[model samples]
Target: MSDYLIVGGGVIGMMMARELSTAGADVTLVDRRGCAEESSWAGGGIVSPLYPWRYKDPITALATWSQSSYVLLAQELLEETGYDPELRQKGMFMVSVEDADDARRWAAKHHRPLTTVDADFLYQKEPHLKENLGEALWMPEVASIRNPRLGRSLRQSLVGRDNVTVLEHQPLESLIIEGEQVKGIKTHKGEIRADKTIIAAGSWSGELVKPLGLNVPVEPVRGQMMIFKAPQGLVNRVVLMDGRYVIPRNDGRVLIGSTMEHTGFVKETTEDARASLYETAINIVPALADHPIEHHWAGLRPGSPEGVPFIGAVPGYENLYMNAGHFRNGLVLAPASTRLLADQLLGRTPIIDPAAYALSGRVTSG
Candidate 1:
């Protein structure tokens, strides 16, 4: 009896349910674990990739559009749900001796506001920074949010509405496909009959669709991050040292991240990863060496081979849709992806061409 059933209760699933329900669709969201218990919970809440110019145009455009909507989206949700999804716009600074040219080229390509500063200038901007530094690139729009809070607010906003329902700890066994059309979903309880279904199951999306003889080219990319509860003024803005970046929260805790490993579903935090994060954080701000490390965690990103998300309809199963494989940029693009998927599912025009994000297209290109 549900018009739409989202098969994951993370940011994507909950946001999509909110969008669809606002468009007057009956919606239910299900998650095997607690809501926002995956990448959405573990993410740094960064609104852009470390270097975004390396990706395709559509990906960049979609992310940009989504990033722009983040402020208003958070405001609206906060107003509706009485929850503050702390979206903070602290700037980003990248310091490096090598990869200078690559950083310059990428920053220019992305139209990021970049400023080249010297050792004295860098120290002046961040007094706690290590003086033994080279040139740095400053990007003003690279912002962050409290992702866990955002996910909770979104779920609350959707669930408070009449047309939305959220089912935590409920897992779908398989999709109910009949002659290339999805009529419902098969789960432990029973068959959930719905007019439309969207698979946004994050890393588990690939395994879930196997019984339906459908494959969405999404793989798990493990990212490990470390948190530092340091002095508030130790670092201003986000800092990118080496391939790793540092994000400072308003609560005097600096988030140091991340390690991109191909290890599948190994969620434990390793000593090497922690050390790597600590060394990088100290390199940016020498004073951070004195602070105690607060947290260390890892999450699985639903990555595609091409690094673009599977955002459109299935080849033979059009009624069954997909919105998975966002990988690291899921937090940045969540709003836009929700709108795009809603547009597609509700027969409205999408913000971008569906062909670019089509699951069938990615499979064929691969």
Candidate 2:
């Protein structure tokens, strides 16, 4: 039997597998697709919370802790896999449409740096910005990573380890519960028994734990993003205006996103969505209108009601654990999530109180 059977091979799943293997556990990761191809690949890969002050203290705290932890995780992944999950501190520029003061107040309450800048200054910094904007707030510590590369690197780094295995295109069917613990999972091919099992299946975590009567409420929130090969000096920091945002990359590819639509398992890219995103991109950074559309894609984020992730064991099941439900934050959260789950599995002091994030209970308010 494998020491641990991880149901998903996304960022959290792969990271947990890496951690388990490093701790001397034989781990096997099974996924319907390759690692990171799920929401992990499709995300904008920003490391900061959307609006930290909008959520509870624990949510912000966990997000903050996770953000700091990823700095080192990126370096380690680069060394181990030779694929860099390009994490850079470009900071974020949040422009106010009409609520500049409200955004600033929220930023202050959350303890995030809020640099108050005028419209002309904003125009000078990013000349392409729409002149109709009101004010701007800057958060310097906010960072981002190349998300697809992170998933690729995780797969590369873990595939060579003797203690771990990654099986792709093998969609999980059901769980095998034998009394007190999970025996294994029944995949399309055959049964693979595991000493212990953890369901880290992004949005699908809910369905996997259902046989054991464990409930992990989750759904997919799809976001469409468009990438453009920027002409010259254009937008730099991540810009959040109205309901839209812009993310820049190391390569000339500046990503303009996104539209939050709740379409169950519909991963198809749409032209209407692309047109909307392209229009929004030009609105945010007018120069983007000049650049040809390099690429456009859509990604599904495993959103929870509370906007916080579920990262602990099932309430009744002793051996079956869960480490999923990290919606838009998965890319920023890979390292911290892995470390905490490792500590929990290895029987060590946890980085935070695991009860808060336990897979059981009504944490929808979390």
Candidate 3:
């Protein structure tokens, strides 16, 4: 019997496996498809929330904590796997000034630096941007990572671990529950027993735990993205306008995304979504209009009621835990979120208070 059985092979599940295995726990991670092929692979990789000032303190607290630990984690992964997640500190430019005052107030309250830049300064910073965009807010501390690479490196780093076993192509059929405790899971292949089970299955977590009478309130929110093959210096930093964003990779690939549609579990990409994303990308940096779209894809984010992830034990189940519902910020929040869950499961003092993300907590939408 394994010490823990984790259902989900995204970044969150992989991170939890790495942590628990390092701590000498027997861990088995099972995924429907392959690891990191879901939302974790398809995200824009921004290390900060979409609009930091617009979220509640609970959400911001988790994001801020996770952002601080990303650099160190990236370095460790690079050293171990020779794959750099490309943790870049290029900062982010928020183009819309409608919420500038609210953003400034939130920044002050959170001790985060937020500067308003005029058009000239913005042009100097991002020369590729179209002219006459007025002023923008500069979040100098914001950073990004290549999330797919991060997920790959994390799985690679755990490949040689003696205590970890990764099972792919195994869809979880149901849970092996005895009264209030979950003994194990029934996958497509066979039964695997474990002392504890964790539902890190992202958007599918709600269905996985419904038999236990736990309402995780996690659902799939489809987001589509378009990749543009541009010059390396096409966009100097991450450019954001409204809800759409354009992220530049170290290579000549610029990622333009996305749409937040509550369309259940559908992960299909639409021509309308592509056109909208392309128009938005061009509006931010007009030069991108000339670049050819190399790829277009969509992923389902595990969105919750208020965008805050659940990262603790269920109310009545002692052996079952959860770490899903991160919405679009899964990659950014994975390190901290997994660490907190691992600490609680291992009976150690968590680095952060886990009460804010409790399963029974009230949803607060800011």
Best model number under lDDT: 3
lDDT per residue, candidate 2, 1-366, as tens digits? 898999999989998999899889999999988888878888888887676556666576677778887788889989988899888787877876466676678767767676777788777767778778866777788888888998898899999899998899899888887787788888889998898888888888877766665556778888888889885457667888777888888876788878888998788899899889988888878877788898888888888867778887777668888887777777666677777888998999988776667765653221
Ranking of models by lDDT: 3, 1, 2
Predicted candidate 1 versus true structure: per-residue lDDT over 1-366, tens digit per residue: 899988998899898998999888899888888889999999898887776656777778778888889889989989999998988877777777365676668667877566677777666777776776776776677778888899889888987999987888868877787887888787787888788888899988877777766666788888989888886777667777777877877787888888898888788888998888788888877788888988899999998865678887766776888888888888888888889989987778888777788776455321
Top-down TM-score ranking: 3, 1, 2
Per-prediction TM-score to the true structure, in the order listed: 0.93, 0.92, 0.97
Count of steric clashes across candidates, in order:
0, 0, 0
lDDT per prediction?
A: 0.81, 0.80, 0.89
Model 3 C-alpha lDDT per residue in residues 120-195, reported as the tens digit of each score: 9888988988777889999998998998998899989888688899999999898998988899999878998899
| Candidate 3 whole-model C-alpha lDDT, 0 to 1 | 0.89
Best by TM-score: 3
Error of 3 at 211 (Å): 1.7
Where is the poorest 10-residue window by lDDT in model 2?
357-366
Quote the positional error of residue 166 for candidate 1 in Å.
0.3
The better candidate by lDDT, 1 or 2, is 1
